[model samples]
Target chain A: MPAQSSPPRTDSRPGGRSARVRAAVHQAVKELLTDEAGDALTIPVIAARAGVHATTVYRRWGSVGELLADVATSRFSGDVVVPDTGSLREDLERYAYDLAKDLSDPDTLALVRAIVGTGGEGAGVCRMERQRQLEAIIEREQGRGNQVPTIERAIEALLAPLYYRAVFTDQALSPEWARTLVSHLLPR
Target chain B: MPAQSSPPRTDSRPGGRSARVRAAVHQAVKELLTDEAGDALTIPVIAARAGVHATTVYRRWGSVGELLADVATSRFSGDVVVPDTGSLREDLERYAYDLAKDLSDPDTLALVRAIVGTGGEGAGVCRMERQRQLEAIIEREQGRGNQVPTIERAIEALLAPLYYRAVFTDQALSPEWARTLVSHLLPR
Candidate 1:
């Protein structure tokens, strides 16, 4: 979990050179992952793309897998707005569809696979973000005096199937499939 | 998917030196995965342990990730005995519990994560094996004149939650949890 936290900034100044370097490195990693074969992704190649010293890149991110994990975490948390459609079913359906779409992207899928491969704090961070979003939706439903499934139940019913298909099977996820999962979770 | 098939044997003789070499290499990979840190795993190290030349290892396996994937596929398919308890509910519960217990082992979990990371044919091979087992159970239930859920539904309800918790959350899966999933799916 230590790697889940951002490393301390070498320069304490706001909007400083350290922040710039981190941003450049992350961008470089994403671009490489998208445009090149996975085998072509190495420290020197990424460093060259970012216009940073290979040692600097190596020092900042111990390995390519860790660098990919960092980028994946930022992309997962920063993007994807949680829906608030008032109805729990609608909210969940929209959320699932969005997730399915995101995972369908080759780059995003690669990032997810990389995170799974890295096998540590990265997956935990992404899971926490997902849990937080689900909790918020549940809390809102409770305030509206509507019965809703537990967050754990929601995850088991709604999220797991989508991810399982995305990662394991070649099955293409669709909006209809997303709606089906939500319906199963909250049958009318 | 090409890698999913075993490479042609250099020695066409049945139970020949090629077969022994493959066995030794697989055993060496499993022992290294169990005993050493993932970082310590390399073609040379595994070759040394297997008493095979590093070039031979590389020529056959290509990379450590692929080698790990091959071992994982063999382990996943070979070790588990699929349940056939006549009753669908009992069969599913036993299956889930066994899967949970297997994934709980650190070595097995590491192998699974490695397979996922390798991405492509390895995950497909494991999924196909699981699907085949489920199909067998469903077919047996049908033969017994009992109604059963589709393989897709079984996967969504029974397997997805187990894998999701294993890979994403730190949640410890229990026998009760496995039974609960089967209950939710069967709903008697």
Candidate 2:
């Protein structure tokens, strides 16, 4: 007799069967979001795209809004460390440029569009996540004995402009522009 | 009689009866949005709240989504002007702080929520309007001549931080923080 076969699975984690299924569903959602525009967002489409049962999608996220939020949040997060160069301006300039680069990337931009489609309802929470990231960076700088005031301000200086350019201006945040911003602000 | 008398209307606009009616409807829609959350957004509810004929709202905007977009767009605009302080850093710092204050204000926050609730369908256009305002400020600064790369960077440094703080951090753009940001980015 053939040896008992192990369950077919795709997830690399040790969370077992449900985790594997969830991982597949999550990946499918991310792909759909990346490929489609805001208007194309829907559950059946996502389920079909992921090759999962529609009920699985519903069970995982509870709603399409939540699912989109999860995809965007996951895609945009994780330990994005802030680099320090002693001078606050230089440090901040690098920080800002890197952030602009990250947000302007194709996958990230798609995630932004998805979250933005939901408008300000989810914006507050989203903003909170960003704030946490900023706070961590600032605190790290402070731990190095940097002046809190200068470093905090530098953090703002670096990031707000790129976002203003993206969300308010509808302009892509270019590396040249980032370099220009950093150069003037840091001047080192 | 010296002249035929017209009835005093709740709408203050000068026009024929239809125009007055339209104004009333618009006002009503605004009030409803201000008071209710996203889930409460609906045509019949809006019509009843506005006290204008429901058909007029539909006729003017075509659908609930369209009407909501129009209302959100019409209520907020990208028209903020940055004051010139003869120092780029100072001006930008003021601009950043003021923008945060404005965007986070109760009225503006509500408007943002309304816009976001629309699922970012109109976000691109709205962002464009905001960009025009920022560009206008930048253009005015450039008009002063003697434009330096550092000053330009200062502009982004000063402004971007506040927005990043507001939209990303979910924290109120504090005046103290603005001052610190300006000091660090601007040359002494």
Least accurate stretch of 10 residues (summed lDDT) in model 2 chain B? B112-121
Cα lDDT, all candidates? 0.79, 0.60
Off by over 4 Å in 2: A1-17, A20-37, A40-66, A77-98, A116-151, B1-69, B77-98, B113-155, B179-188
- The best candidate in terms of DockQ: 1
TM-score of each candidate? Answer: 0.85, 0.61
Per-residue CA lDDT of candidate 2, range A48-108, in tens? 8778888978787866667767665665566566566765555555666777787777666
User: Candidate 2, residues B1-188: lDDT per residue as tens digits?
Assistant: 57547776555455676676666766765676566343345566777877777787777776555665665566546456656777655566666676667767755555554444344445544444454555555666677884633434544655456545555445676777667766665457
Q: Model 1 — TM-score against the truth? A: 0.85
Candidate 1: which stretches are off by over 4 Å?
A1-15, A32-36, A40-51, A63-66, B1-15, B31-37, B40-51, B63-66
